[model samples]
Target: MERDRISLTVPTHTDSPAQQVVQYAQNKDPPSRPLQNRLRKTLFIAMPPKKRQSDVVRRKSRQSDVQPGDPIPNRGKRRYRPGTVALREIRRYQNGTDLLLRRLPFSRLVREIAESVRPRGEAMRWQSQAIQALQEAAEAFLVHLFEDTNLCAIHAKRVTIMQKDIQLARRIRGVWGGLG
Candidate 1:
């Protein structure tokens, strides 16, 4: 009959602060299980009906069993020859071709020329054009990168805001209250 623990006939959203009294009364275990069991006994609940029902509905979601002695389908096709033995001729030809390419001096010259043109003062007209093209390509790449990053960050911020709003709504029972 105490005011804090009292219940009224009509619903008004206010919970009593008398829960601490129940908490202190329990020594090691809470009596919530007994209270819940009593509640379930008194309540006549109906489940929401499913739109469709089938014989295999409850059973089809599980993995099909494969017995130990059963011959696995496509087992022979799964076998792959070891690459070291199977690709021996191809590997020998690749090594020979790689050695031939290494013997050529023009590729190394192209690499050196590529490195030298990087300086603003040393860059020739063609070199500068190539560098400008590279710069343009890099700028385009960066613009897209930043745009995606900012978009993702903005989406994350919006999600955080929505979550805060939901939490705030829960705390105040649909009334506006600051996030807990």
Candidate 2:
């Protein structure tokens, strides 16, 4: 039988002549203050003094510059009678008020539903209010499902509802008749 031997190599560090020169350069002190003062005097010049504000001419304030307590000048006049201008204003107000309504409008709901389902395949078109009505219906369905699931869990003599309880609840409610 042959035995395998392993050899270890250790690294030895010795400072070269260039390293010694670098060490000596690092230890050397900076130049004396007299040389620094002479260099600054020769290389740098003093700047001219700035003029005082009182010596310069004062600028008069323009009409465009608004002062404190200045009443804002009205740019446009309001219409008193129901003219074309009044009708346009009324329409703008109605549109703004409609946007502030709590329920999502029919057109916006349809657009949102279309955007959500677009990635499934070719875009499916739906009528206005369809998505909003569908959402309300689904909410009601979930409420009923949760109630039925709670009852199922109670009937099974369990306080905590499990997946099996939900499955049994759905079976009792016949909600997934066509799902299979």
Candidate 3:
């Protein structure tokens, strides 16, 4: 098997700024170079052979440049947008399981929904447990939506989730009685 090697000549002078930079860059090793007052010493290092093409990364091919007159091919499905990284991150953060225990921003909306469900004549002030329960339920709902949508996207061999993925997730999760 072939091996790679690198050799560097280093000076032992303590006053040279370039030698100081090299010393700082490789601080883990002791200065084993010959300490001759006037002569420089050579340092030999052995490195492993270069990796094969299979060991190196294989990146996706970029789209070819198209002229204005070129007609785009008709792929049945529309491609996902690449610029929604922040939106996906926010969705994941909002759907985090920890949010179920903490206060949710939509707690007020939950309270209003609760108020609407109550009988018209009676005044009902929501208790802390009721609000907490509503918040937890909302969090669970969001988590389910995000998780199901992610699964739907993965099922279609896509990294980015599209609107169709969400719609399919809603159907699979029986959000609207599985009409689809």
Query: Residue 31 of candidate 1: its Cα lDDT?
Result: 35
The lDDT per prediction is: 0.44, 0.56, 0.65
**TM-score of candidate 3 versus the correct structure, residues matched by position:** 0.40
**Highest TM-score, which number?**
3
Q: Positional deviation of 60 in candidate 1, in angstroms?
A: 99
Pick the lDDT winner.
3
TM-score-wise, the better of 1 and 3 is 3
Candidate 3 ranges with C-alpha deviation above 4 Å: 1-97, 100-104, 119-121, 175-180
The alpha-carbon lDDT assigned to residue 165 of candidate 1 equals 45
Model 1 steric clash pairs = none
Model 2 bad stretches (over 4 Å): 1-122, 126-128, 175-180
Which scores greater on lDDT, model 2 or model 3?
A: 3
Distance from true position, residue 155, model 2, in Å? 0.8
TM-score of 1: 0.20
Residue-wise C-alpha lDDT for candidate 2, range 54-102, written one tens digit per residue? 5354333454477879998988977566578767876886566233233
